[model samples]
Target: MKKHIILSAILLLAAALLYCSGDRQQVGQVTLEWWQFWTDPAIKPTIEKIAADYEAANPNVKINLTDLTWADGHEKIVIAFSSGTAPDIIELGSDWVAEFSSAGQLADITEDVIKDTANFLGWSAGIWKDRIYARPWILGTRILFINRDLLRKAGLGENYVPINWDQLKEVCYKIDSLGKDIYGFGSNAAEKHRLYKKFLPFFWAADGRIVSLDGKYSVFASDKAYRALKFYKELSDSCSMVDTQRRLEDAFLEGKIGVIISGDWLLKRIKNENIQLDFVTTLIPGPKYPGKSFAGGEYLAVSAGSANKTEAARFMEFITNKDNQLLFCKANYSTNPSSKAATTDTFFTSDVNLQTFVKQMNMSEMVPATPQWVYVEDIIERMLEDVLFNDAPVAESLYEANHKIKELIFKE
Candidate 1:
């Protein structure tokens, strides 16, 4: 009740401000508060330089930047919105946009974003209830990384990669036959933010979607979803579920795991480590959806509380424009540019492995855009954990999860 009251007050305040702005626009020195999550020592300086360049172009505008960490950034963002103190421009994970946008804490920038990101991928995540609330800032996709040496030692073909879920299971079991320490697959078990990411591709490839495209209802307990869960659960003997992607990547890099699905960031680490073992990248195997992968992207949104929304919108435009998008992707090699022109840059096309990531991105699916997703995902993850680790029947687990999701989306 208190939270609703606070959000109501914020919405009323935004309404009044929107009316006043229509009457008279503010004209003076403006400082746009930007909250971004690129806090790495290497990436932070690049973001700062972009801001510096934007400031130089618009002498009257100043960008006040705040650094956020992924560990607690979402919590901080929620607190900011609850307290009505959100920054003018804030960076959000592709998955986090729906919650804030649904709360009326984010400004509707649909026209502006559609104009700028016509060629952008993963726009579905930023659009909620048919309105665009955020613009795609950076995009990335995950691919299967194979340990070829491990495959050879397991007596499997060195260059062979699984093309379907059944093939993947067979390969995993083959690697398991190699030794006690060697696992066929590295999987994320019950990790909250990540488990769904690993599971969704299979769910999607099975021709099952979690919710309707319009975000109207739940559609999770389909035969395809049940089969996907059953298949994943069956691989339990040959797979180990780690709690974090870093752990999964580490196990794979140490040659303890034969097959792992990970992002392009892992590629960067592999190049840096310069390991002697030969590894290859390929699309994640799927049944009905052959090469499905998960699409992830960063988004920039303007807060409804911003007194200078026009300026904030311009700032976002400047930051996400093609030139700056290219620059950002160059500095951050793990991400692919969302723009058509930027993808053609030699930075992406010249590399055979990076090109695979691009293909995966093209074949990937964004998570559902429903506001209920935030809560529903918890239910889905718990259901997956129950099925995978607790021996819960897949059909029963998915059916119960669908019930929970329906309640979340339709409850009064």
Candidate 2:
């Protein structure tokens, strides 16, 4: 009996040693932190699947995805970076490419990976100072959205969606003549930063480019910009619902407006409801040039100080790939395709209007990738409201806008 007890004790000790050794080896696996602004119900599941599949393939690594809204995403990411808790992989707006990259908060990815940017639209929007920093997972560009149902009622449904801004205005006049209370065209002219989102599309149609390629200063006071602003004010005079982009989006979902310039979210909203709404998208056209729109997209980046950079980057690559992007887009019904092959998915390729956005991706010009651009945009937004709502003359107002922007940007 004594010999048996001693043998049992020895076996138990050996078992404990083996368990401890195995645990230590497993501890070396990495955990990567990824952040994004995808709180929409349709989007969360797709992102989760991507993360799960990636984790399954990389058993040695773990991905932690943090999702938020656009406003919330910007605020929280700024806070996290400030608090030194930035994630390994961060997905942000192109508008923020300069803000975060300039602060030395992002990893320099120019030479770190092989990229086929030519195959992707808006892929080059996030570059700053000739260095690649973040990569886009999804994108949105401004496009013309017309309601065929309303156009038909106005006796203009015969391929009613126009090819140029002037034709669009003519169509609006026809609709306006139909009723006093109803509007033929409506755009979100009152939203804060959103004004630029709407205005840039029209401005570009006038052969106007908002940002200088050098990323130096605001060109909003240029002749093209003045024409864009003046034209916007004129459009609003006949349109009802001078609401924010959010409201314009909501209004579009309810089929309350005739036409709008909006993002992919509007497409998803209409499709999800199975509304028998007939709609189409077209390029903004100008006299001497084709209409242009702002091209912007969502990007995923790794934090320079993250403990899981490698794992996070790998997850980003997997998520942004064709298979995962297609799955997510098909399930959600609203995402802009990121990968070249993903655009061929029957769900997207079958829709003519949807493809217009994908095509516009090529003609898009990214917003200025300068650290001071946010403040500059703010100045532009406020001045636009003044020009539209107030009696401020265009030239004086723009000069003041330029001066005010210079003050805010240069104010230490």
Candidate 3:
């Protein structure tokens, strides 16, 4: 009996040693920290699958993904950078790339990745001071969302989508005349940062710019800018501006709003909520040209302080390549592929509704790539609110905003 007990003890010790050795192998492997905010219940699994595939292909390297919430993700990123614990690969919002790259926190990948970026609609957002610091991963755009039922009730045909700003106003007024609490258009008011994107298309179509080419001056007080602002104010007056985008969308979903300019996320929400409403999206009505949309997207950037930059870049390239991008965008219905091949894939071309946003990509433009963009955008939002809500003159409000932004741009 004593001999048998000693043998059993030796066997247990050997098994424990073997298990620990395997654990140590995994622990010793190079693991890159990936911080991302695609935490939707449905989309999270797709990301996990991608990570698993990447790990299967490269056994020597592992990815440690930390899911983030949109509400506090930016704050958390700033904290991580301040504490010297930033992740190796970070997924940044379209507006955040310039802010981070300008701070010298992002690795320059101009020569190594996507050298010919003219094909990507939102590529300019990832560049800071003429240096490419991030790769465009997912692209999307806003279109004019129309309520077909409301149009029919207003004695308009289902195919009566506006082709220009003048037609939009005429249609809006016709719908507003329907009475019974129905509104012509739903425009956002007083929402910080959001107000800029909502109105930027108009300014861009009018050939107005938010900043100088060198990004060192504010050009918001130009004649074209004033024209755009005046037009927006007049449109809002006709539509009856709502205090928030959410309210605007809700009104649209309820069939109380005849028209609204909204992002593809609204389409996803409409489908998920199963709202019994007939709606369609089209290119936003333009002034000087056809309608234009905001080219919004997400970007992947390697941290300047990351020890595993090569691995991070490899993973980014793998995921954003044409095939993978097409797969990912297919899963996320509202997302448009950033790659040229993915953009032309049958997945997009086959669906007429999807093609609307895909076609708008040709007429889309990204916001100014400036480190001070956040500050500049805040001033413009206030200017918009002053004219749209406070009844301030468009020219005067724009002049004040231009002056404030000039101070921010030229400040030492």
Most TM-score-accurate candidate: 3
Q: Sort all candidates by lDDT, best to worst.
A: 3, 1, 2
Model 3 bad stretches (over 4 Å): 1-29, 116-119
Query: lDDT of each structure?
Result: 0.83, 0.74, 0.83
Candidate No. with top lDDT: 3
Against the true structure, what is each candidate's TM-score? Answer: 0.89, 0.87, 0.90
Q: By TM-score, highest first, what's the ranking?
A: 3, 1, 2
lDDT of 3 by residue, 125-211 (tens): 888877889998988888888889988988889888888889888888888888877898888877776888888888887878878
Model 1: per-residue lDDT, tens digit, 199-266?
88888888788887666778899998988777766675446545478898888888988888888788
- For every model shown, the clashing-pair count is 0, 1, 0
User: lDDT value for candidate 2?
Assistant: 0.74
Clashing pairs in 2: 284-291
lDDT tens per residue, model 2, 198-292: 77777776766545556455555678778877877778876655777777666655667777777777777677776666777776555334677
Better of 1 and 3 by TM-score: 3
